[model samples]
Target: MNKNKNQYINREISWLSFNERVLQETADVNVPLIERMRFLGIFSNNLDEFFKVRYATVKRIVDAGKTGKSVLGGEKAKDILEEITTIVIKQQSKSLEILGAIEKELETENIFIIDENEVTDTQAVFLKSYFMQKVSPGLLTIILNDLREFPLLKDTAAYLAVKMVLINEVDGNENKENKYALIEIPKDIDRFVVLPNEGDKNYIILLDDLIRYSLRHIFTMFTFESISAHMIKITRDAELDMDNDLSKSFIEKISSSVEHRKISDPVRFVYDKNIADDTLSFLMDKMGIEETDSKIPGGKYHNRRDYMKFPSLGRKDLMYSKIDPLPVKDFSFEGSILEQIAQKDYLQYTPYHSFSYITKFLREAALDPQVRTIKLTVYRLASNSQVASSLINAAKNGKQVTVQIELQARFDEQANIEYAEQMQAEGVKLIFGVPGLKVHSKICVIEREENDKIKRYGFISTGNFNESTAKIYTDYTLFTAYSPLLKELNKVFDFFETTYKINKYKHLVVSPHYTKNVFIGLIDQEIKNAREGKDAFIKIKMNSFTSYKMVDKLYEASNAGVKIQLIVRGICCLVPGVKGMSENIEAISVVDKFLEHTRVFIFGNNGNSKVYISSADWMTRNLDFRVEVGCPIYDEDIKQELVDTFEISWNDNVKARMFSEQQDNAYRKNDKPKLRSQFAVYEYYQKKLNA
Candidate 1:
């Protein structure tokens, strides 16, 4: 038996494969042209994060001089690092090719992305004025010759490495004294500069090209021959290091770590392949880049992620048509949303159904005289969060508002810290996090003095409370009046403040304690039912699944004749469709306009199906390290609705890619009517409204 044949796939490689599926959207003809360009942005942004985190982790293992086979599935740490670089290089090349094709297509649509040399005389005047007024003042320009120490390049910012050949004869030979300079791109300015429309045609110049056009203005002091600027970007390891200083506050350690990130070791250096060899070498030598660090020779544009903010040019036809989120059926803003929840459970499927219900609930809680206290757990919030404002409002209204804010939400630590201090100042009590656990659960519960007895109403979500992501991320928020569940949700908030008290939950499958065992028990029930001559099946939808324990248990269930179906969006390590390993299991991934973020697990318990909505994936961190919550759907209607949504996604022939041993990301095809699941989900909600 070959160990690698039917075993788990490498999580890093699987993630890259998932990102390739995202890159596929860039080349997919069916996607909107502008949207396809933005897909390239998404792909680039995804790769940047991959290098900062995953690649950095593998590199650390190799640096620590360990094979890391036990931690890294089976591959040695060095081998995985090399494999990642190879895959990234190939993907980056493919992305560039796809970008070239899109540019040509844009030209046919009368949208021209011109270079510096291609700017018209009128456009030149516009560019000069714009650069002087907007781009020049804040720009940091460093001349390399006289400087004893190299200025620290910002981790988030890209730089233009300028090579000016001093043609005039000095003590040196001709072109011998090439003066090197670095110009950091202004972060405030927009990357895409829209040139004035020429008749019916739309023209745009990238910020780098604009800088290239005005390079002389930036470096007027130097005696020059021909000068050229090539873009270069470096990604530093963004992992936060918290030293054991018992005196320092948690926020202090986090803040210091964030500041330390600016000077962290470079994990990847992306430079223009067209750049002169000397320029690249100068950067490499000065930056102290090692052989192990990924040095990728990329296209002229290093940060194509700026394309995510590509101007729409008012060409709605070249973009996705925006859909207004519909109001939930049987729910209205006229009366208390709590009153409606008192009647029956309502599920808020955001970006399909308006996320307003969440805000409305919080706003109502803030103003309601009967509402005495509010408790919530926040992992991430919007840039300008109405949710935070509502919590503060409740606090001001003399309500005891308590927030268990997780300070360790990656990439959003600064934002979380800012919100935490603001809320604390406004009289809202804030809990940083548990002793060792990141509170990943999306929950909020409020107690109201109803009829002289305390009645609790709250929501449990599979996504963050952030309204910004609610516009595009597909997630589930269950608005329930069930006291048992709310009581357990409150217990979770209690557990955040008091870590030693391990409360048993009857309704929620919580992490670090019960999630693994509870889920495994559920699978065991399915396995037994399958063996006892009963119809048995399991359907799970999540963003990732890398837990070997979960995978092995699923395989055991599959061997016992239990049919298992998985709809994992991003990283899936389980090898489905193997003859003996997982012949009864099948998996598919959907990467479309809206990210598939809802985690719904459905199990066929004899004839009745048991359903759960979770903030946790099957990954080890989610199940063991994070304070994740998986809420069982006790309301039959919501349970059925979740299962229906899962089935809709599962049966998708369009935009659905089958997960097989080959990992080719092949789209699923069928003779049945073509259904794009995201669109169908919208239609599904729409029908509910009309009904």
Candidate 2:
């Protein structure tokens, strides 16, 4: 129990710790071989984003000559940046070792990941043809030495820095000259090139090595003594810089900013460790990368994120068994989904339950003649979104469709903008949210005319409405016909249009106005109950908890003897289990097959517990800057179900890692029987369906 004077951990450091937990999955033997590789990919992908956003923010602070202690959790910005770089270098080194181990284990399963030099003559014949046909046309090779201006490297794309020692015959005098070139890895082509199978064994080579082997063909015009290529990538600042131009629309501004991100300041520069020093220095100098920038030395591969799409190779035995998304216990798609909701509120826990219910609800509203209006919020959508199509369908019908599509949903901004344009063109009224606030709440309300009375039905969720993410992100979506709650939900959309008028919510907790106050009031009640010895406890599950004010209030409650349990998946700043500070609070994080994205809060109010599912984490932006919504579970059955699920997650002994003052991600173990919460949760739903 190492204790520090600081009450909260630095949010950036805590995020790195969370990613370390993801990296741990790559080394866990219980994880399937291919899945372990994919976990490595996930770790790498998470790091790339961290540098692009979080690391870049600290860099800006340092550049601005500000200490940034208040905003950065009592640490100076420069010191935090140095600590981050040190941690990332070590994590990158460990990930390479884990990758090597996974590759060895993959060999045991009759799968081989070989390099270019290891390619057989038979494979070489196939590789040459493959490169000439599929890889040659898309390749963009730039000769750097002769160009007056350096090319602008795309932040998302990795490149092969090629160094060739050429024999330049000037007037019959053979002079040795160094020629440098960069070959952009084609994003259109697959990174993993599967060779023809030899008997029962499978073989795959990365696209980088394939291009390495065919370099002579690409530069036939140059007479070179030797040639070599190594991977290099740059991650630029991804913060969208919006220009103040009243002439342009919001979508146009976002589109321009996204385009500008291609050449923004580089926050990170990653190169293969095997690359020559001169080549590394040359690329850095040409790209104007400073020594102060985060330069990470990686393995032969740069974008291991491509491993996330590593070919399945039709090997089911080497992968975890996929489970069929279950149906909600008593809810059915056979009849109208809206009608079923009118009876009692039901919860749809996705990745365990089918996401089809959401689509079905929208589809029904589109076709139902009695429905007069459909209103929803869009954050991120799938490539071909059935949700957007259903909204368009509703508009095509007589129903008035209103969608508050957020154009600033980070990395998915372009996709959201496209959907907004298409929806707007199709007669769906579009609201781009409030000027400063991002509409992150996942709520939809519909008005239906039943016997001359307009009845409201809607759902509030703790995750995005994207179909693709719903399959992997564990979220809670509550379907209800409760008029009071739905009416408040409508007020959220109303606030989007009329920004000056602040609306009051009795049934729903809306952010940017009342989320922090409401939550603090709940914590205060728990503290009072603890003082009176009335079974006081608070259980919260969220993706992140970084608000220092909320953290201090929880610490105050902990001192008052209120038992608090937190299951935060990432970026938790509060230090739990500290004597005289937070001895009564215990926190754990779960990183497993599915992402823990649901935000649930349960307060024991003297036998009458209060429960809520929200889109907001306990972060500053969520509490003060964004428009988020938290909905109460009024139905007894559904409230009990939420409690049951949270208990199961809290009881997880396998995947759960305790949060401590030391910041070590040690797994929670005990004498109790092993319960992997993810697996147990699916089983729990199965039992409910059977019972």
Alpha-carbon local distance difference test for all models = 0.92, 0.94
User: What are the per-residue Cα lDDT tens digits for candidate 2 across 1-691?
Assistant: 2335868999999999999999999999999989999998899999999999999999999999999999998899999999999999999999999999999999999999999899999999999999999999888999999788899988889999999999999999999999999999999999999999999999999999999999999999999999999999999999999999999998899999999888799999999999999999898888888888889999999988888988899998878899899999989979889889999999999999999999999999999999999999999999999999999999999789999999999999989988999999999999998988998999999999998999999999999888999999999999999999998988898999999999999989999999999999999999999999889999999999999999999999999999999999999999998888999999999999999999999999988999999999999999999999999999999999999999999999999999998889999999999999999999999999999
lDDT of 1: 0.92
TM-scores for candidates 1 onward, in order: 0.98, 0.99
| Candidate 1: tens digits of C-alpha lDDT, residues 1-691 | 1244549889999999999999999999999999999999999999989988899888888889999999778789999888988999999999999999999999999999999999889999999999998988787888886777778887788999999987676667555478899988877899999989989999999888999999888878777878999999999898988888989998898988888877888899999999999888887888888766888989899888888988899999999999999998889978889999999999999889899999999999999999999999999999999999999999999999999998889899999999999999999999988877889999999999988999999999999999999999999999999999999999998898889999999989999899999999999999999999999999999999999899999989999999999999999999998987889999999999998899999999998889999999999999889999889898888888998899999999999999989999999998999999999988998899888
Best by TM-score: 2
- Clash pairs, model 2 backbone: none
Each model's RMSD to truth, in Å?
1.3, 1.2
Error of 2 at 304 (Å): 1.0
Model 1 clashing residue pairs (backbone)? none
Candidate 2: minimum summed lDDT over ten consecutive residues — where?
1-10
